[model samples]
Target: MADKLKFALALALVAAGVVGFYLLGEQPLVLRVLAVFAGVGAGVGVAALSAPGRRFIDFAREAVVETKKVVWPSRKETVQTTGIVFAFVVVLAIFLWLTDKSLEWVLYDLILGWK
Candidate 1:
């Protein structure tokens, strides 16, 4: 119940910030932008107090940690893999083109005598 209230308050805060931005049409751009940022920042702070919010933050942190631990391919390995992929793609394209031409020849020249 408390968590739901917190979430709702957060959403309201964000909406208010957006509304304020539009409402302050005659105001300076800096002020309008500041209003939006303040609202969103406050909303996020409120939301972060909720159970689900905490879980999401934890998940995000863990994701960053895991991403950092990843063994990314070196430049050489990346280039080699890319070259292999391009070669395979070229070969496949040629094979497909030959197959299509053979089918077309069989249908038009041999069977229908249209060519």
Candidate 2:
């Protein structure tokens, strides 16, 4: 219950900051930006104290660990894969273009007799 209230308050602070940005349009740009940043920072700080926020932080840390464990492809492998993809795309495009031209010729020259 307390966590929920903290989350709600954080959300309200962020919302107020966004609204304040518009309301402070006549003010200096730097001040308006600062106000918005302050609001967002405060909201995030408050929300960070909640259970869900802690869970999210844990999840993010786990994700980073998992990401670090990933075996990324080498630069050479990446280049070879990209080259193969480009070759396949070029071949498919040529095939489709030929198919389209053949159909156009058959329809106009043979069947329609308009040519």
Indicate which candidate wins on TM-score.
2
Computed on alpha carbons, the lDDT of every model, listed in order, comes to 0.98, 0.94
Candidate 2 displacement at residue 10 in angstroms: 1.4
TM-scores of the candidates are 0.82, 0.87
lDDT of 1 by residue, 22-99 (tens): 999999999999999999999999999999999999999999999999999999999999999999999999999999
Candidate 2, position 46, lDDT: 92
Q: Per-residue lDDT for 35 in model 1? A: 93
The true-versus-predicted C-alpha distance at residue 107 of model 1, in Å, is: 1.8
The pairs that clash in candidate 1 are none
